[model samples]
Target: MSFYSGIDLHSNNHVVVVIDEEDNKVVDKRIDNNLHTTLEVLAP
Candidate 1:
C-alpha cells in the first residue's frame, strides 16, 4: 500500500490530510503550527 499527504499551512494552524493510493482519506486534521504536532499527525 502507498500513502500520500498534503498540508495546507496557515499563520497559526494548518490542515493535514493523508490518503492512500486509491484516494481514500486516511487521516484529516487541523493542528497547530508546531513541529511536534505536525510530526505526530503525519506519523503512521
Candidate 2:
C-alpha cells in the first residue's frame, strides 16, 4: 500500500495530513514551523 502526505503551510504553523492508499486519513496534525517539529509531526 502507498501513503500520501499533504501539508497546509502557514507562517507560524503547519497543518499536515497523511492518507493511506484508500484515501483514509491516517494522521492530521498541527505543529510549529520549526524544521524539527515538522519532521516530528511527519515521523512514523
Lowest summed lDDT over 10 consecutive residues: which window, candidate 2? 35-44
Writing each residue's lDDT as its tens digit, candidate 1 over 1-44 gives: 99999999999999999999999999999999999989987877
Worst 10 residues of 1 by lDDT: 35-44
Model 2 gets an lDDT of: 0.90
- Using lDDT, give the best candidate's number: 1
Q: Give the CA lDDT, 0 to 100, for residue 4 in model 1.
A: 92
CA shift of 10, model 2, Å: 0.8
In candidate 2 the C-alpha lDDT for residue 11 amounts to 88
Clashing pairs in 1: none
Clashing pairs in 2: none
For residues 2-36, write the lDDT of model 2, one tens digit per residue: 99999999988989999999999999998888888
